[model samples]
Target: MNREGINVDPQGRVAIVLVRARNPLNIGAAARAMSNFGFDDLRVVNDYDVPFAEARSAIDAAPVLAAARQFGSVADAIADCTLVFGTTALGDRRLQHPVELLRDAGPHAQAARMAGGTVAILFGSEKTGLSAEEMSHCHRLLTIPMHRGGVSMNLGQAVAVCLYELARDGAAPRTLPEEARPATAAELARYETLLREVLVTSEYDRRFPGNMGEDALRRLVRRLALQGDDVEVWLGMLRQVLWKLRQ
Candidate 1:
C-alpha cells in the first residue's frame, strides 16, 4: 500500500504481536486494525483466550486472525524479526532499551522494512503491560504520547495507534552511503555468547557478579545497533581476545 510517499508492503515484513492478551475481543480488534492497515502477519506470544479468529469484532479480518501464529515466548515470536519494537505507556517500570516516540519510529521502522528486514511491534496484555523480561527481547521501546493523568490505553487501541503511525507515510526513505543491513537475532546471539565467553575468560564476570555485569553488557551491545558485518568483526575480535586470555 502507498503510505504517504513510500510504498509499504505490510504482508511479509511487518508483524503485530499480542503478548498474553486476556480478552479475545481485543485480539479480534487488533486483528481488524491490522487488516485496515494492510498488515497480515499476526503473532501471539504466551497463552491467550477468546477464540480470536471467531471474534465478531474482527469483522472482515477473519483470515488475518485465523492465520495468526502462536508462540511460547517472546524470543521465539521475534526470532525471525530483525527489529522488535515493544509498545509501552511508560509506567513506573524501568526500561533498558532505547525509547522512541511513536511519531519518530515510523521512518526507522519503514526503513528497516524497506531494507528487507522483518519488524515486529509488540503489545502487552490488558491487565499488565510487558514485563521487564519480555521487554528484554525488544530492540527498542515505543511509547505513545498521553496526557499527564497517567492513564493507559486498552490493548486493542494501543495496537491501532502504533500501526497507524507506522503505516502513515511522511518523508522519502533516506539514502545510506553503504547498504544498511541490521544483524539478525541469531547473529546477535552468537556475538553475545562469544562476548560473554571473553568476559568470563577475562574475569570480568568475577569482578561484577550476578545480573549487574551481564545485563549491562547485553544492553550496551543492543544499543550499538550492530550491522551484520559488525557482528562478524566483533565476534572475531572477542574470540581472539578470549583465546589470548586463555593462553
Candidate 2:
C-alpha cells in the first residue's frame, strides 16, 4: 500500500517552511523529503533562487518544488497557519518559545491538524539557524535528539527527521476533545500591535527603553496560545486602556 494513500488527511494542512536557505540543492532535498512524507505545502521565506526545483537532488520531487510558495518573511509565510513550530538545534541561545523534543512534537502537530487548523514547521538557514526575530513568530521550538557532541544535521536532513516523526505520530487517532480554534497569526499580530500601542501610551517603553519590555510582552502573548475569543478580549482590554489613557 502506498504511504501517500494511508495518511492523507493532514498532508494539505501541514506546511514545511524554509527560511533564507542559501543553497538550491538543500532546498531541493527538503522538497524531496516532503514528497517522501506526503506533505506538499512548501513556503520559502526570503531570497531563494527560483530554479531550486530543478536541482539534481530533487529527483522525482520536482512537482513539490514547482508548487512551492515564496514569502517575504516568516510572519507572511505563516499568516494563515494557526499552529507554528520552529525547528532549532538549540545550541546556546536562550529562547522564549517552549522547547519540545522532536519526537514529542508530532502529537501537537497532529492535534492541530485534526482540529482543522493549518500547521507550519519552520527550518532556518543552514548557516545561522533562525534569527531571534524569526523564532519569535513560532509558537514553540522543536529540537531533534542528538548526542551532546554531535554535529548539527544538514538543512534537508533536519526537515526529513521532523516530518518523519510528524507523519509517524499522525497515524494515531486524536484523543483530545475538540476545543475553540486557535487564533491565526494575523489575529495575534493585530493584538500585538494594539498591545504595543497601549504600552507606548502608558509609557511602559519610556520606563524600560530599547523595546525590551515590548519584545518580552510579545513573546508572553505568543506563549499564552490564545484562542480567537481570548485574543478579542485582550485586544478590547488593551484598547480600552489606550482610550482611557488619552482621556
Per-candidate local distance difference test:
0.80, 0.82
Off by over 4 Å in 1: 1-7, 10-12, 48-61, 170-247
* Global Cα RMSD, each model: 22.5, 23.2
Candidate 2, overall lDDT?
0.82
Off by over 4 Å in 2: 1-8, 48-61, 170-247
lDDT of 1: 0.80
Clashes of 1: 0
Report the Cα lDDT for residue 157, model 2. Answer: 95
lDDT, candidate 1, 124-190, per-residue tens: 8788888888898888988999997866788878888887786555332333287769999899879
TM-score against native, each model: 0.62, 0.62
Name the lDDT value of residue 146 in candidate 1.
93
| Candidate 2 TM-score versus the reference | 0.62
Residue-wise lDDT of candidate 2 within 108-150, one digit each (tens)?
Answer: 8877876889999999988999999999999999999999999
